[model samples]
Target: MINLPMSAPTFIKSAEIYRSLRKKGITIRKTIDCLIAVLCLEHEVRLFRNDHDFLFIAEHFPLRIV
Candidate 1:
Protein backbone atom coordinates (compact mmCIF):
# COMPACT_ATOMS: atom_id res chain seq x y z
CA MET A 1 0.00 0.00 0.00
CA ILE A 2 1.16 3.52 -0.77
CA ASN A 3 0.02 6.96 0.18
CA LEU A 4 -0.14 9.46 -2.65
CA PRO A 5 -0.28 13.11 -1.77
CA MET A 6 -2.61 15.52 -3.53
CA SER A 7 -1.28 19.03 -3.45
CA ALA A 8 -2.67 22.28 -4.82
CA PRO A 9 -0.88 21.86 -8.09
CA THR A 10 -2.26 18.35 -8.50
CA PHE A 11 -5.79 19.55 -7.88
CA ILE A 12 -5.30 22.33 -10.41
CA LYS A 13 -3.97 19.86 -12.93
CA SER A 14 -6.92 17.55 -12.34
CA ALA A 15 -9.34 20.38 -13.02
CA GLU A 16 -7.48 21.28 -16.18
CA ILE A 17 -7.71 17.65 -17.31
CA TYR A 18 -11.43 17.65 -16.64
CA ARG A 19 -11.85 20.89 -18.56
CA SER A 20 -9.86 19.59 -21.46
CA LEU A 21 -11.96 16.45 -21.63
CA ARG A 22 -15.11 18.51 -21.50
CA LYS A 23 -13.89 20.66 -24.35
CA LYS A 24 -13.50 17.51 -26.40
CA GLY A 25 -17.08 16.48 -25.65
CA ILE A 26 -16.04 13.82 -23.15
CA THR A 27 -17.84 13.77 -19.86
CA ILE A 28 -16.24 11.90 -16.97
CA ARG A 29 -18.80 10.43 -14.58
CA LYS A 30 -16.67 10.96 -11.50
CA THR A 31 -14.25 13.64 -10.27
CA ILE A 32 -12.15 11.11 -8.32
CA ASP A 33 -11.21 9.41 -11.56
CA CYS A 34 -9.76 12.67 -12.84
CA LEU A 35 -7.77 13.09 -9.62
CA ILE A 36 -6.45 9.53 -9.89
CA ALA A 37 -5.50 10.05 -13.50
CA VAL A 38 -3.58 13.21 -12.61
CA LEU A 39 -1.74 11.35 -9.84
CA CYS A 40 -0.72 8.59 -12.21
CA LEU A 41 0.42 11.12 -14.76
CA GLU A 42 2.47 13.00 -12.16
CA HIS A 43 4.08 9.82 -10.84
CA GLU A 44 4.68 8.40 -14.32
CA VAL A 45 2.77 5.30 -13.27
CA ARG A 46 0.51 3.25 -15.45
CA LEU A 47 -3.09 3.01 -14.36
CA PHE A 48 -5.00 -0.25 -14.44
CA ARG A 49 -8.65 0.54 -14.72
CA ASN A 50 -11.78 -1.02 -16.17
CA ASP A 51 -13.69 2.21 -16.36
CA HIS A 52 -14.47 3.45 -19.85
CA ASP A 53 -14.08 7.08 -18.77
CA PHE A 54 -10.35 6.45 -18.39
CA LEU A 55 -10.10 5.76 -22.11
CA PHE A 56 -11.14 9.32 -22.83
CA ILE A 57 -8.71 10.77 -20.28
CA ALA A 58 -5.91 8.60 -21.63
CA GLU A 59 -6.56 9.90 -25.10
CA HIS A 60 -6.03 13.52 -24.10
CA PHE A 61 -3.35 13.13 -21.42
CA PRO A 62 -0.14 11.12 -21.41
CA LEU A 63 -1.72 8.65 -19.04
CA ARG A 64 -0.65 5.05 -19.47
CA ILE A 65 -3.57 2.71 -19.20
CA VAL A 66 -3.08 -1.00 -18.75
Candidate 2:
Protein backbone atom coordinates (compact mmCIF):
# COMPACT_ATOMS: atom_id res chain seq x y z
CA MET A 1 0.00 0.00 0.00
CA ILE A 2 1.16 3.52 -0.66
CA ASN A 3 2.00 5.39 2.50
CA LEU A 4 1.25 9.01 3.26
CA PRO A 5 2.07 11.12 6.29
CA MET A 6 -1.37 11.67 7.75
CA SER A 7 -1.27 15.30 8.81
CA ALA A 8 -3.53 16.47 11.61
CA PRO A 9 -5.19 19.09 9.44
CA THR A 10 -5.72 16.63 6.64
CA PHE A 11 -7.34 14.09 8.95
CA ILE A 12 -9.59 16.76 10.50
CA LYS A 13 -10.54 18.18 7.14
CA SER A 14 -11.19 14.74 5.73
CA ALA A 15 -13.40 13.79 8.65
CA GLU A 16 -15.31 17.06 8.43
CA ILE A 17 -15.85 16.58 4.73
CA TYR A 18 -16.90 12.97 5.23
CA ARG A 19 -19.39 13.89 7.94
CA SER A 20 -20.90 16.67 5.88
CA LEU A 21 -21.21 14.43 2.89
CA ARG A 22 -22.79 11.65 4.94
CA LYS A 23 -25.30 14.15 6.35
CA LYS A 24 -26.20 14.96 2.78
CA GLY A 25 -27.14 11.26 2.27
CA ILE A 26 -24.12 10.29 0.27
CA THR A 27 -23.12 6.63 0.71
CA ILE A 28 -20.09 5.46 2.68
CA ARG A 29 -18.49 4.49 -0.60
CA LYS A 30 -18.95 8.04 -1.79
CA THR A 31 -17.36 9.36 1.37
CA ILE A 32 -14.37 7.16 0.56
CA ASP A 33 -14.45 8.60 -2.93
CA CYS A 34 -14.08 12.05 -1.42
CA LEU A 35 -11.25 10.87 0.81
CA ILE A 36 -9.47 9.57 -2.25
CA ALA A 37 -10.00 12.98 -3.79
CA VAL A 38 -8.31 14.64 -0.85
CA LEU A 39 -5.42 12.20 -1.00
CA CYS A 40 -4.93 12.71 -4.71
CA LEU A 41 -4.97 16.46 -4.30
CA GLU A 42 -2.52 16.41 -1.43
CA HIS A 43 -0.08 14.08 -3.21
CA GLU A 44 -0.59 15.43 -6.71
CA VAL A 45 -1.21 11.92 -7.95
CA ARG A 46 -3.68 10.37 -10.35
CA LEU A 47 -6.37 7.92 -9.25
CA PHE A 48 -7.76 4.97 -11.12
CA ARG A 49 -11.29 4.12 -10.14
CA ASN A 50 -14.49 2.81 -11.64
CA ASP A 51 -16.74 4.60 -9.13
CA HIS A 52 -18.89 7.20 -10.85
CA ASP A 53 -18.52 9.82 -8.14
CA PHE A 54 -14.77 9.41 -8.25
CA LEU A 55 -14.85 10.02 -11.97
CA PHE A 56 -17.09 13.02 -11.45
CA ILE A 57 -14.81 14.62 -8.88
CA ALA A 58 -11.75 13.77 -10.92
CA GLU A 59 -13.29 15.54 -13.87
CA HIS A 60 -13.72 18.80 -11.97
CA PHE A 61 -10.68 18.52 -9.66
CA PRO A 62 -6.98 18.32 -10.43
CA LEU A 63 -6.95 14.53 -10.84
CA ARG A 64 -5.92 12.40 -13.72
CA ILE A 65 -8.24 9.39 -13.92
CA VAL A 66 -7.27 6.24 -15.67
Candidate 3:
Protein backbone atom coordinates (compact mmCIF):
# COMPACT_ATOMS: atom_id res chain seq x y z
CA MET A 1 0.00 0.00 0.00
CA ILE A 2 3.05 2.20 0.21
CA ASN A 3 4.18 2.23 -3.38
CA LEU A 4 1.52 2.91 -5.97
CA PRO A 5 2.10 1.22 -9.27
CA MET A 6 1.56 3.06 -12.53
CA SER A 7 0.66 0.44 -15.07
CA ALA A 8 -0.31 0.66 -18.71
CA PRO A 9 -4.04 0.83 -18.06
CA THR A 10 -3.51 3.52 -15.48
CA PHE A 11 -1.83 5.78 -17.99
CA ILE A 12 -4.43 4.91 -20.56
CA LYS A 13 -7.20 5.84 -18.12
CA SER A 14 -5.41 9.08 -17.36
CA ALA A 15 -5.22 9.92 -21.03
CA GLU A 16 -8.89 9.13 -21.38
CA ILE A 17 -9.78 11.45 -18.51
CA TYR A 18 -7.58 14.19 -19.94
CA ARG A 19 -9.27 13.95 -23.28
CA SER A 20 -12.75 13.86 -21.78
CA LEU A 21 -12.05 16.85 -19.60
CA ARG A 22 -10.40 18.70 -22.44
CA LYS A 23 -13.44 18.19 -24.59
CA LYS A 24 -15.54 19.67 -21.82
CA GLY A 25 -13.17 22.67 -21.69
CA ILE A 26 -11.98 21.75 -18.21
CA THR A 27 -8.36 22.61 -18.57
CA ILE A 28 -6.19 21.18 -15.82
CA ARG A 29 -2.97 23.13 -15.57
CA LYS A 30 -0.67 20.30 -14.52
CA THR A 31 -0.22 16.86 -16.05
CA ILE A 32 0.50 15.45 -12.63
CA ASP A 33 -2.82 16.75 -11.40
CA CYS A 34 -4.59 14.97 -14.20
CA LEU A 35 -2.74 11.79 -13.41
CA ILE A 36 -3.61 12.02 -9.75
CA ALA A 37 -7.23 12.75 -10.50
CA VAL A 38 -7.47 9.74 -12.78
CA LEU A 39 -5.81 7.57 -10.20
CA CYS A 40 -8.33 8.57 -7.56
CA LEU A 41 -11.22 8.10 -9.94
CA GLU A 42 -10.14 4.61 -10.86
CA HIS A 43 -9.32 3.54 -7.33
CA GLU A 44 -12.24 5.27 -5.59
CA VAL A 45 -9.84 7.12 -3.34
CA ARG A 46 -10.95 10.30 -1.65
CA LEU A 47 -8.70 13.29 -2.08
CA PHE A 48 -8.17 16.03 0.49
CA ARG A 49 -7.07 19.14 -1.30
CA ASN A 50 -7.74 22.86 -0.96
CA ASP A 51 -6.76 23.66 -4.55
CA HIS A 52 -9.34 25.31 -6.75
CA ASP A 53 -8.30 23.16 -9.67
CA PHE A 54 -9.35 20.04 -7.80
CA LEU A 55 -12.72 21.57 -7.05
CA PHE A 56 -13.20 22.26 -10.72
CA ILE A 57 -12.09 18.75 -11.58
CA ALA A 58 -14.43 17.24 -8.98
CA GLU A 59 -17.34 19.09 -10.48
CA HIS A 60 -16.82 17.34 -13.80
CA PHE A 61 -15.45 14.06 -12.46
CA PRO A 62 -16.73 12.05 -9.51
CA LEU A 63 -14.29 12.50 -6.63
CA ARG A 64 -14.62 12.66 -2.85
CA ILE A 65 -12.61 15.73 -1.96
CA VAL A 66 -12.50 17.46 1.39
Candidate topping lDDT: 1
Go through the candidates in order and give each one's C-alpha lDDT. 0.91, 0.67, 0.78
lDDT of 2 by residue, 1-66 (tens): 677666777767667656665566654465666767777778877777777876556544566777
TM-score of 3: 0.79
User: Model 3: per-residue lDDT, tens digit, 1-66?
Assistant: 434567889888777777878898888777677778777877788888867777877887787788
RMSD of 1: 0.9
State TM-scores per candidate.
0.93, 0.62, 0.79
User: What is candidate 1's TM-score against the reference?
Assistant: 0.93
- Distance (Å) between predicted and true CA of 42, model 3? 2.5
Indicate the residue-level lDDT of 23 in model 2. 68
* Best of the two (2, 3) by lDDT: 3
Report the C-alpha lDDT of model 1 over 22-47, residue by residue, as the tens digit: 98889999988999999998888889
Residue 59, candidate 2: Cα error in Å is 2.6
User: When superposed on Cα atoms, how far off is each prediction in RMSD?
Assistant: 0.9, 3.2, 1.9
With a 3 Å backbone cut-off (N, CA, C), the pairs that clash in candidate 3 are none
